[model samples]
Target: MVKTIITLLMMIILFLGGTLFGIDQASEGIIQTRGYATADVKEAVQPSRDEAGNVEVELLGKDLQQVTFEEKEQEFQEIESSNFTQKLAGSMEKGVSSFYNLMIQSVYQLVQVFF
Candidate 1:
């Protein structure tokens, strides 16, 4: 029983761990959740005095406009870009969940057998 649980946890961790790479918008693009745009920058609450210490959030323009308030947003009319790497990476990255899920299911079956 202990071995099964340990094995299950190990499988879950290994499945989630990996080098994820790809071209994603450096910021959320206009097409992302249209109604919620976040700020472009902010003060980092963390204690790191690195280069551009300021924190920048990636959000789509429409979302940004909506966030800042539409009346104020209308003044800008429009913004643009296609710098999303994570989304593109998501498209290109291989789906590895199934194999691990199968392993877990197999364990479940084996555990059931023992019971």
Candidate 2:
């Protein structure tokens, strides 16, 4: 019985390891094929000195212009004002419980199959 249990555990470990490896390989392939892995970094915008000798920097891209300090502050305030942490904790708890239940069920099925 002990030998059988050990064999089962080893098989489960191997299966999980193979699945994870396969997923990692697939994701890497997808990234390479989609050109996501070869993206070039944009050149940094150089700061210019104004008439008053004060250094002024201008954002070069539309993406940079879309993001502002006020927008970030508002997003932060919304998160702080809402029960974000509590909600996150609740969702995480549910996910953990469901995963635990699934593991239990799978183990029970495996035992039944072996017996």
lDDT of 2 by residue, 1-115 (tens): 9999999999999999999999999988988886756356344575567676666665554222235679899999898889878989999999999999999999999999999
Report the poorest 10 consecutive residues by lDDT, candidate 2. Answer: 58-67
* Candidate 1 per-residue C-alpha lDDT over 21-65 given as tens digits, one digit per residue, 9 for 90 to 100: 112352355536554555643333323233555433434322211
User: Relative to the unseen true structure, what is the Cα RMSD of model 2?
Assistant: 14.9
**C-alpha RMSD values across all candidates:** 21.5, 14.9
lDDT of each: 0.55, 0.81
Best by lDDT: 2
Report the lDDT of model 2 for residue 97: 100
